[model samples]
Target: MHSSSRLFPVALVSAELRGDLTEDVYRLKPNNSPDPSVELALTRLGLPGREQRGAPVILVHGSFSNRRFWYSPRAIGLGPYLARAGFDVWIPEMRGHGLSPRNLDYSRNSVAAYARFDLPAIAAFVVEQGGQAPHWIGHSLGGTSLAAALGGGYLAPEQVASVALFGSQVSRDYWALKLPPVVWSGRFLLKRMGVIPGPRLRRGPEDEPIGLALEALRWYGLFGRFGERGNDWWAGLAEVRAPVLAVSAEGDRQDPPWACRKLFEQFGSEVREYLCLGRRQGFSENFGHVEMLVSKAAQREVWPQVLHWLERQALPLQANGAGGAAQGG
Candidate 1:
């Protein structure tokens, strides 16, 4: 039993052993006083016998994804990879995704809501349990939300030891979405459906609410800014002080390398590193969006580099190759 679970309004849903690792699942009540209900689930993994593991690292899945994206039931992927390396790995399945049950306002889920509410709760919880600031790794929209959390000041700088944004960028321009008529039309159509079927759309394994789609309206629409009600997250990114690493893939058409770089440059952190998962960076091949992290190539190539980043907080020695580290942690 986890001490945090016993102290907080949380339930130990399950405790399973997978080979040498232990997986503990917890269901937490919403930390919001107004919405004192359920919101999300966390899957924790750690070496069972280790008296003192490394620092905690929280992995946030992107849009149309869940905890399984980080750590599958078969005990594969980055979550387990970090766990085996003695890092306290935590995977959070956002509302209505994976182990998390949707609340009544399920259809109203948005990045703003996630940044302002869910992440704060998560950060507080992780700090409480791990007794230290946790490093954050987010994929795609997961990365975007984490950016929003930091930019909007919802997540304090001291609460974060470091942050890694994989395949994440908000600077990509959508000309069509910028038009008022187009934004209105798209919102109308999405509202009628309420949710986007991820599998049907061939996006991923999970479904997304209509509210998430409205981000384009806020970001690319008339007088667009990456925020709502006059809150500008894009400008806010300049205030972030945590050590930051931003990764972009050459083959990612969704969030191109240029745009990813643009977002990376927004961070005001004195310590910032930008990595490109492409041949130009000396990797074996030009890595695609999903393949950059989820493919077998990533397992063999990219994972070690990421693990090195988390462990050492330094940029990889890309000249050496995929599994290359910069002569340190």
Candidate 2:
């Protein structure tokens, strides 16, 4: 492991050889973000002796979830699946989630901070350790942050090989929330709460800082846009030329297929594809937002499709022209 005093300091906190994969946990403290004490945790998984076999993949979890979403306590999840399949997988826990310690400004954490600081630092650390740019795969809010980073130009195309988003949507047409009075009331209530209690709300496993709620409000509110700066994230999508894969589910009412498709259509990548998981699409079951990535059915049917996307993205850009077919149900 490298010394922790260097620029983009990273420390290997633990390592163990699980059943078929080697799991290593790392702590990174980049000096760029607002809170220097904030250390992000990244869990890396790879085959016992083939750590350098394929392109590295960084998996970002959604809001209210952590690294366990990718690699559960029992060692059977997408992270392990990819590691066993010969891909170096790294799962990063967002601030205050999972193994990452909460920052002093945890109450003020938002997608802007994540896109401008966290993702770039994680990508830099991965590139420094792996000696190459990594392919990024994000779920829900994780994907939203990835989109913000890409559109805001925080994560340049040269730093990323490809992008994949599962159940991620930027459009908001929720009837209740769209009402001006409801938006005002919701924003007023969220401003008083330091954080939204996810457990109490039965939303997920962890609490989300109110900052995220406020950010979402601005996005879904009247005249809402995507980034912190005046940068039009939705419009800026047309500038990203990296290969992209946007996956949606027919059962994902939280982020519907049409909304997910809208986000996909904004991408300027000539080599982008859309996938909708449903029984009508030949999938065994109608995958929901979480089921699209976590359910056992996903392991059996959807994982191979993800693997195929990764393999295709690994190809040179010049060779991707013939591979631009958008597939879904």
Candidate 3:
């Protein structure tokens, strides 16, 4: 580990060898974020004996979810799947989700804070420990934050080997929310609630702070931009050069394929690919938003596709073409 990593106030909260994989949970308290008291939990998974065999892969879970989304309680999911496949996998829990306790400003947390502060810290810690830039894979809001980080230059291209977004989209055009009155009214009501009850709303595994909803409403509103600063995150996407893989499910009503494709098309990466899941695409079922990453069908059909994408990132860039090859299924 680097001396800088040693200096980072990260505690090893737990460690246990589960079957062929060793699961370790870490609590990182980086001083760079606005909330110094915020401790982010990162779960590391690797084969018991081949810890350093492959490049590190960071799995960022979507909103209303946590590390468990990547690696469920039963030891199934992409985290273990990647680890078993020889890659060093790290699953990070956004503040107040899963094992990470709520911070003082829990209710105030937004994607801007996550993109500007939390992500850089997570990247720094991963790089410090892995001794190399890691591949970033995110689902839903997790993917949106990664895109924001890249666009805002919070996470530089050199700091990331590649990026893969699953069921992630930023070009939200919900008719109901797009209206000015509805947007304003929704923001007001949500902010007053302080937080969204994910379980009650049937959204996901955990509650999402109202700040996130406000941010979303702002983005979906007319004349809304992504960054907390005056930065145009979508416009800024034209500058990101990292290899990207954008995945969308055919049946994902929450984030439709068209919107997901819009997000993918904005990326300026020389190496990028788009994959859509559906029966027509040879998938067993038309995968939904959550099913694209969490269901057993995903484990059987989609995991190998992800592994293939990661393996390709390790190869030398070719001159015949930039990496933006589009494919289906």
TM-score of each model, paired residue for residue:
0.94, 0.92, 0.92
For model 2 the local lDDT of residue 195 reads 87
- Score candidate 3 by lDDT: 0.84
| Candidate 3 residue pairs that clash | 270-323, 271-323, 272-323, 272-324
Q: How close is candidate 2 to the true structure, as a TM-score?
A: 0.92
Ranking of candidates on lDDT, top first: 2, 1, 3
lDDT of 2 by residue, 260-307 (tens): 889988999888878778866666778999999998899987787788
Best by TM-score: 1
TM-score of 3: 0.92
User: Model 3, stretches more than 4 Å misplaced?
Assistant: 1-4, 314-329
Tell me the TM-score of model 1. 0.94
In model 1, which runs have C-alpha deviations exceeding 4 angstroms? 1-8, 318-329
The sequence of per-residue lDDT tens digits that candidate 3 reaches over residues 1-329 is: 32235747888888998777889888888877777789899888888766355798999999999888888777899898998888889999998999999999999899988898889888888888888889999999999999999888889766799999988988766678768888878877886898899999988779999889888877867767766657888888889988998888889998998888888888898888787788766668899998998888988878878888899843222211222223522
Clashing pairs in model 2, backbone N/Cα/C closer than 3 A: none
Error of model 3, residue 171, in angstroms: 1.2
- Residue-level error in angstroms, candidate 3, position 252: 0.6
